[model samples]
Target: MNHSVDIVLPWVDEKEPGWRQRRIEYDQGKEIESTNIRFQCWDNLHLWFRSIEKCMPWINRIFLITCGHVPDFLNLDNPKLRFVRHDEYIPKEYLPTFNSNTIEMNIHRIKDLSENFILFSDDVFPLLPIEEEYYFKDDMVGDEAVENIISTGSFTKGLHEQRYAQVNNMFIINKYFKKREVQKKDWNKWYCEDYGDRLDRTRACVYWYDFPGFYDPHMANAMKKSTLARLWELEPDALDAGSRNKFRGASDVTQYLIRYWQICTGDFVPRRTQGKVFFPTIDTYKDVVDAINNKAYQMISFNENCTPDEFEIMKRDINASLEKLFPERSSFEK
Candidate 1:
């Protein structure tokens, strides 16, 4: 089966304009540029779009979650893209509580869509190619990670307890597994203090951290649809509650899920290392591109002394580091 991936771009309309322009100027140490805060917001969105374009070859579906003002170009004729507005999925009472309503909309979308798919945030761009083996692993869930999350009582303490929920950023879920049953089995009761004994008897496959941090940390997290469907079956009205109130921002759900996994599973997943490159802050996109071409990592700090030749050496070093880390995949000829 072809693995479907969901790219979630949750955005708000209130950000400062020309923020991107200013960021470029700040990075380049250029003269005072126009501070049209509204422009910055759009520019950032544009950048996100560019990043998405770069990742499109590997992804299957792109879900744009927004409160208001979706770019018309996106909605006009993209077959692979779907625009989900906040008002369409979220309840009226729970709307105002969230800083960005798109997150709630995303959750609702995930719940409604029966297909199994991988989810991603727009801020995160895939820098390297993804192999099929990374996603379809025999042991997607780590036992040690789950045990760590359980030990922390994530289900019984703090915001998790207050909201009676656990959140995750990227996870695999399908409609076949009866996750509702697992949710109803006391383990879902975030407020309950005695969940330890009950959890030991359950068969929940959850990994606390992203496995093989080498690629994308969000890539391998999976939950069978059967698992989530079971949870919903157990608590028919579980999604009806205003669960967003207990957290600070849109990422709370995923963050909580990570913590839950950690508490339940003691093993911490290591983040992958890619060769680091420097990003220069320049007044114009061309300057930024030039800096990248030259391999200037310190230019982001506005280092005027950096010469073009020095930047070249930096690029060579970065390539060398990549070669060391990924000898087999390294493109540099010996």
Candidate 2:
């Protein structure tokens, strides 16, 4: 299948005064005021772009979902690369109260557009090019490990309404099917006072129990354009317009939909793999380089330990495969 994957990242500029200081303060144990919160979201933006460059011969469109202030240095004229800003889709009235900008943008895009694409976060750095098989691998890690993590963490039982639903941050959705199913619901009243309390309770329970291990509650996931359009049809006002300007507080809305799906349909398949090879977070450039080297070593070790001759053959084959996959990247000077 010729899949169109849209890699999305929300970013903000650092030129604003005290931005660096704010990040440092927040990273430390200091009690910085929430009003003055500053995150270097662009750092991850650059990393994501670099990874895309390294794994080239781009398969689909790359969408940098932002709220206008994208740095000029990162600008490029690639036909496949697009920048979708929040103000374009969100209504001005509800922007202030919205907490999560990232989720809202995604929902807005899904609601307004009708394409099947993958959504990704800037924080996640792919060390090596991932083939289709790597994404849909068998023998996946299950809910058991996630359950163990929740049990050990600060989670309480019965706080949430549902069980057996786990959250994995990275996932792929067949948007065409998802959007078709969403049109039948009434989203305006979904979060009303009567339903809000119950939903909150359920979410709290899921967060405490099913978040870390089973799901990547923090990372991004993939879905189809049709699914988003249906969500928009159900609740054009579902996202708070004000929160779209920044990256924080958006996942809550995303989680709301995720939870709704869990209740409506009992399908929660893990999308990305979680193991030594796939690190969930990357804090620095060194981290990115290390991860790639590690994966290469692992591939080599697997072959060498079993058959030394095969080890050399595998290296040559892998290099050839990469070259074929990314011809432009040969000049990347790695």
Candidate 3:
């Protein structure tokens, strides 16, 4: 399998009037399942592109997934840029969806998407130069197959829904796979040294008869289109039910299911899956800025769950810091 990797980046312009109106209209009479922070813009998407052009230039194409709006700074003419609206690839029956899982799981239907591609969220940034081999090597996705369990006891009420989705994924994973069987085929792949201290989690869970759960790394995910297709083929009702979720619901299985599937099937190459994650708060503002400026992580995510006031301050300060690192316009921008 040739590893021609493309980047599937899903973005949303929540401030766009028409999209916002539709979102508002959709949310009426329903218990709010998500928050504005999940949809808020950082005014840093151009910087995201700049980081990509500067740090990861070998990408074959960047499919910018959007509901309808595209960033004004994007160079639509760039050969590596491909703007994909939700309706372009997602089936019509699943339209008007605000669920990221629905939009992502259906991405294999994109006619031009490469078989081997990486899924990037709008907020995930590549902080330093990265090689294509970092994402794909020897025709296997570079990822860790760490095992774990979801504990509602540890999560707050705000995060209970996320736990539910992970539990749902495990149900399907356990449906198709047995832990002893998967590990018996290859011990090293399941307990590789690349996982560092994290391998202990797998060892802890190994005593179980089946997969307990998988650690959902917050960084970008590498995947195979065929794997996505295979997952849907094996479990259409599950994927379709997830797609029909207009908002992320408790029953939904996220795109992480595909990654979990890959791990169980041993279709991935074990790699160090460590990456720095920051949830911006007033107390940690300086730390986030320092990490971004210093290039502390190869991959990083700024989980946007801070207070609006805090987010505004962090957004302003962080983008300013990023501007200093990527001072010039990348070919990605006009």
Candidate 4:
């Protein structure tokens, strides 16, 4: 029983030359404005790899997907790591993409990617010593904590439009499974039972939830390459909807589709852990401190929804915490 699993991280260097101009040009004529490009890298690649080496040294090959923006400090000579640019696997038509969704949709196409792999972002790091079983048990993926999918009420109210895409993707995914009718009913019922009093029943909109599973946070996400390939074969339209967008859009499918598809198809094994995995919204210094103090959290992530000033503050705090947590340089560092 081979339990080997690999790691894939989709990263970007926001300050890459011409990135701003390219993004501006790409934005011309799109129906929706995409904020996915607003993320800050903070040059944390070395720190993130160091965390992996410190906590999960047994991980197989690490694939860093980027737009040819390899970190200057990265040890390209490291045998266990590979740098994959968008031109390597993603179709040429979708090149020069700032859309994370487009990049995520094509990661499974990486050559020789392990059948079982864990997908994470550079902003996410393992908080404590983690075992292979933390992400995969008995060769099946599932262990990272999951949250309930938001249904009804303000899924589309935000100005940023990321959540709007999330909800729309969920609807498309359900429709593909032919579960739209029943899932819609279940969602309406759940919404009523949970928030019946707060809402105006007369004006409530019917929203669908991915009931069996919800989009987990930006922490490490486990995935099976074959399952993702199957998703592409089964729902090319959905995949295309996500891929064709130059940026994140309202109809774009999320990376969660891979996780949810695995759950829906019975390909996953629920995590055996007893306690919750802490992936806090990085709103303040306290949140980062709380995660640091709590060794129980196996993984953590810093989402990029804050103001530019706040982002700078959070990055300094997070990088400092990471430096303290993983002091020794990893072999992946130059």
- Give the distance in Å from residue 133's predicted Cα in candidate 4 to where it truly belongs: 1.3
In model 3, the Cα lDDT at residue 253 comes to 86
Per-residue accuracy of model 2 over 31-56 as CA lDDT, tens digit each: 22232323322233443455566643
Query: Each model's C-alpha lDDT?
Result: 0.36, 0.37, 0.85, 0.69
Q: Looking at model 3, which ten-residue stretch has the lowest summed lDDT?
A: 29-38
Candidate 2: regions farther than 4 A off: 17-38, 41-44, 96-98, 101-106, 110-114, 132-214, 217-220, 234-252, 255-289, 296-334
lDDT of 4 by residue, 1-334 (tens): 4467899988877787677678778778562435542555676789889889888888988998888877888988998998898999999887778788889888888998899898887767777888787678787776422335454454343334576666755665565554444434334432333333333331233243334335355567788998788878877886886688787776677778787666555555554332233333354555765675565477776555565666677677777777877889899988
Give the number of the best model, judged by lDDT.
3
How far does residue 268 in candidate 3 sit from its true spot (Å)?
1.3
User: What is the C-alpha lDDT profile of model 3 across 6-92, one tens digit per residue?
Assistant: 999988887899988888888774524355777777999999889888988888899999997878888899988899999899999
Q: 164-216 in candidate 1: lDDT tens per residue? A: 23322223121222343433342433213333433343333333222211111
Model 2 error, position 93 (Å): 2.1
Deviation from native of the Cα of residue 276 in model 1, angstroms: 8.8
